[model samples]
Target: MMYKFLFWLWLFIWCVQPKQSIAQTLESTSQEFLIRTISQVDFKQLIEKIKTTHPLIAPSIEMVRCIAPTLSVWCVRYTNRATLPQFLTALHAFPAVTDIQTNHLLTKPRGRLISDPLYTQQWQLVNDNINQNTLDIDIDAEEAWQINTGGYTTHQDTIVVAVIDEGVLDSHPDLTHNIWRNTHEIPDNGIDDDQNGWIDDVLGWNFKTNTNNVNNDGIGHWHGTPVAGIIGAEGNNGIGISGVNWRIKLMSLVKGQDEASIIAAYDYILTMRKKYNESGGKQGAFVVVAHASWGVDSLKAADAPLWCAIYDELGKVGVLSVAATTNNNTNVDTEGDMPTTCTSNYLVTVTNTNNFDEKITGAGYGKQSIDLAAPGFNSFTTLNTGTYGVFGGTSAAAPYVSGAIALLYAMPANRLMDSVKAAPAQTALRLKQCILAGVDPVAGLQAFTVSGGRLNLYGSIQQLSAYYGLHQSASILGSLNAYPNPIKEHLFLKVSLTGATRLTIQITNLSGKTIKSRQLGTLPQGIHRIRLEMAHLPNGIYLCVVQGSAGRQVIKLIKK
Candidate 1:
C-alpha cells in the first residue's frame, strides 16, 4: 500500500509542478495568463484594443517582465472574476494573438532532515566500507577535492553556476561567501550601471517580478539553497556542507509559477554568457553551466519544442544546462519525458542513486534519453531559512553533474575547456564529451542510461591531466610504498615528502571508483608510517593514489 501511494505521489508531483513550491508562489493570484502574439502585432494598439473590447481583464505588454524582444508573447492579467476559457476565447479572437498557454507552477523536492558532521556521513563523497550492498557508494567527491578545492585559484574570473530555481538563501551562513557579485553594476544605484537591460542587478535578475531583487528562497520553498549548496557551497569554512565547486560563484535565476518566468530566466543566463564572452571576461558572470532540476513530467506537452529549444539556445552561447530526469520510475525513452528527451547536446539528464550504488525505486530511467546517475538519495546539503537537510530526487542528482562540470572548467590544467571557451558554438558538445568519457561503468546500467556509468570526478580529472601532459608532472613523495599486497582489510602507507606537507590518499577500484579517501594535513618530512583500515572490502584488485602539493603517485593494490 505504501509503495503504491508513494508511486502515485511521485507521479502526481511529476505531472504537476515537479516540486512542491506552487503553494508558495509569489506571483499575484489575480488570474493572469500568458499569450504569444504575432511578431508584427503593434504593442500599443493591442493594449488599447484589449481594454476597449474586453473589460473583464486588464491587459498590458510585459516589457519589464518579458525580456525577449524577438518573442511576440505578451502576458495578460484578469481584473474581475471571469471564466478562463471565456477569457482565452475573447483574447484569441484577435488576429494578433498566435498562441495561449497557462502558467505551470515550478517546485523542488524534499527529504528527510538530519544533523551530522560531513565527510563520513555523506556516502556520496566517499564510500566508507566494502559492503556487498551496491548502495554503499559515492561519486569520489573527496578524491576530487584533493585535485582542487572549489577555492582553486585561476588567473581568470571565478566560475559561475546559474541556478534556475525558486531562489537561494542570499544570506545563508554557508552560501554568502561564495555568491556571485556583479562588480560591473553597483548595488542600490537605482540606475543601469552596466546597462544590461536591468536597473540594479547587483547579483542576478529575478525574472518573475523582473526586478533586481533575487531573494526568493528564504520563505516557504527550500529548493534553491540545497541545490546551490550541492553545486558550490563554500568549502573548508568549518561551517556547513561542501558543494561540488566549493569556491564557485553561484548565480540565482528565479523560477516562477509560469512558463514565461522560466523562459525569462534562461534568457538572463543566455544574455550573461554572451556579455562575458563579448567583453573578454571584463563584464558578465563567467557562467559555464546552468543548473535546471525542474522540467515537465512527460513530452506530451504541445509546447515541447518551445521548451526543448532552451538547451540549444544556451549551448549556442557556451553554457551547458544540467537538467534532471523525471523522479517517477518509468522509462522516458518509451512513455517520453520533456527536456530530458529534448535532443540538445547541451542537455545532460541526471537520474538518482541511493548509497547502495543502486537506482532508487522512484527515480526515472531511459537508455537513450538519460545521460547518467549520481548520488541523489538523502544528499546532505544546505536548506532555506539557514538550515541543513537531505534533499532526495533527480533534482538533487543533477547538481552533482553541474558541480563536477564546474570543477573541470575552473581547474587550471583543463586545456580542452580553455580551447572550447574561445568558441561558444562547440562549448556544449565538447563539455558533454569531456564529462561522459570519465564515468565508472555499471553492469546493470547498460540498458538504463547512455553513459552506462555514474559520474567519476577523479577519473575525469585524470583524463584531463593526461590530455594536458600534466600527468605525473611531479612526484613530491619519492618512492612511496604500501605494505601487505593482497592482504585483507588493512594497509600501511609510507610517505617521503621534502618537508611538512599535506597529503591525500585514495583507494579506488581498477575502474577508477574511489573506495576510500583520507586527508592527512601537514605531516613531518621524514619517513612516517600511516595505518589505514579498509575493513569490509570484498576481494578485488584496486589502485591507491597518493596526492600532495608537489605531485601525485599511483600504486596498484590487491585484496584476498
Candidate 2:
C-alpha cells in the first residue's frame, strides 16, 4: 500500500511542476485597464459602458484601483476568464480606453562570453570613429569623461543604480567593488537585524523568494552581471573594462519577478534612498535610478496598474527608471511593448542601434513610443568571471543610458537645476530634459524616436555648460531648433546663443537652393525666433543653417 501511494504522488508532482514552468499563473478573476475617463466619463459610467460594449465580462467581481492619476487612471476588475483576450483587444479601439493590460510574467535575454581581451574591444565606449569611415558612431563617452571621470565630488561619492534583471555574478573581478551592500543587516545571523522585513539581506534582496539568498541566481542566467558591468564596472582599475560611470554603486534586483514583486523591489530601493539622504548619507543606498532590462513583450492594461502606481512614488523620491524596448525589428508604435510603453514621466524608454550608427535588424522602433536608441549591437563589456563579451539587444542599449544618467548627475558643471533655483521635483525634471535636449539628431531616426536623435553625452555636457554660463568663450556655437515639424503653412525656429554675437540664418532644399535668408545683426546673447513661411513651398524635407561668431550649425526640417 505504501509503494502504490508513493507512485501516485510522484506522478501528480511531475504533472503540476512542469505546468508551472511552462506557463505563468495568471489572476483568473482580475483584469486591469487604463482609461481617460476623468473628463470624458465618470467611474460608474465607464464600468457600465465597458459592460455594455462587451457583455462577455459578465458576472463581474469587485473592482479596485492601484493608481488613479489626475489625467489618466488605472482600474482593475474581476471578469470572465474565457472572454478576457477578446474583450481586451476589442477595447483597443475604444476612444475612452487607453490601455488593456494583463498579468504577464516578464523574461530576460540570455548572454554569453565573447572575448578574452582588455579595454580595446569596448567599442561602444570610444568608437575610434573609424567604423569603416563613419566618423561618430559611438556615444562619445571620452568627451563626457573629460568633464567628469566619475571621480569623487562634493555632492556624493557615487550614485546608486538598482539593476532589475535575472541575476548577476557578484564575484566578478571588475564588478565586485561596485556592488551595493546592505550594511544595516547582519549577514548570516538568521535574523532581520534592520527590521526592514528582510533577514540576512547583506546584499540586495532576492524578490523572487523574498529572501536574502541572492547567490542562487541559477547557473545559466547571465544577463544581470553584464548589464551591471556596462553601468559601473570600475574604471582605471587596470583590470578588465570600464562602464559608463567609472565610479558608481550598483544595487542588484534579480528578476523572475511578478508585478507585486517588482513593486516591492522599487519600494525597497525607495526606502533605502530615503534613509541614506535623511541620515546625511549615514545609512541606506542613495539610488538615483533603476535599470530594468527585462520585460514582457506586451503588457495589457490589467498587468500595469501596480507598476504605474509604484513609478509615481519613484519620481517623488528623485529617482528615474529606464526600460528597454522589445528587441524585434518591428515598430512598437503599431504593435506594442511594455514598461517602455507604460505612460510614466519618470520612465525613459531605450531602443538598440549598431556600429554603423543605424538601427539593427532585430532592434525595435517607434516614432511616438520609443524615446531614443543606443549601441546595443555587438557592444563589448564584462561577461562572467574573468571574461569579456560582445552583446547586442535593447537590453544592452538600456544600461548605456542608465550609466549616462549617472554621469550627468556626477558633473559639478551641471547647471540643469542651478540657475532657476529649482524645487526637488523641478530638479528631476531638469535632469530628464537635459537628456532629451542634447541628442545628435540621427537622419534615419527622424521619424522614429521622439527625440529623432541618438544619445550624445558631449552635447549634453555642452548644454549644461551653456546653461550655467560656464563656457567663457563669446565665440559660442548656436543651436538651431525648429518646431511644428512637417509644417504645412509656417514653421518657428529658435536660434540659441551662448554669448552676444551677429547671426545669419537661412533655409535650403535638397537641391541646395536657398529658400530664404534672414539676418539679425548683433542679436543679444539669448534665443531668437525666426518664422519661415512654407505654404508655397513643395512638400519635401529641407535644411536650416545658423552661422554666427561661435560656429556654424545645421538642422534638418520637414514640411508636410
Q: Give the runs in model 1 whose Cα sits over 4 Å from its true position.
A: 1-117, 130-136, 151-153, 471-473, 476-560
**For model 1, how does the per-residue alpha-carbon lDDT over 69-129 read when each residue is reduced to its tens digit?**
5897655544333334444445555656655554432221101111224633455665534
lDDT of 2 by residue, 233-348 (tens): 88767788888887887888766546778878888888876666567667776677888987777564345777776666787767788888888877777676777777778788
| Model 2 residue 451 distance off true place after TM-score fit, in angstroms | 0.6
Best-fitting candidate, scored by lDDT: 1
Look at candidate 2 and tell me the lDDT of residue 220.
65
User: Candidate 2 has which clashing residue pairs, if any?
Assistant: 32-302, 100-300, 100-301, 101-300, 101-301, 101-302, 102-300, 367-448, 475-550
- lDDT of each candidate versus the true structure: 0.70, 0.68
Assess candidate 1 and give its lDDT: 0.70
Cα TM-score per model: 0.65, 0.61
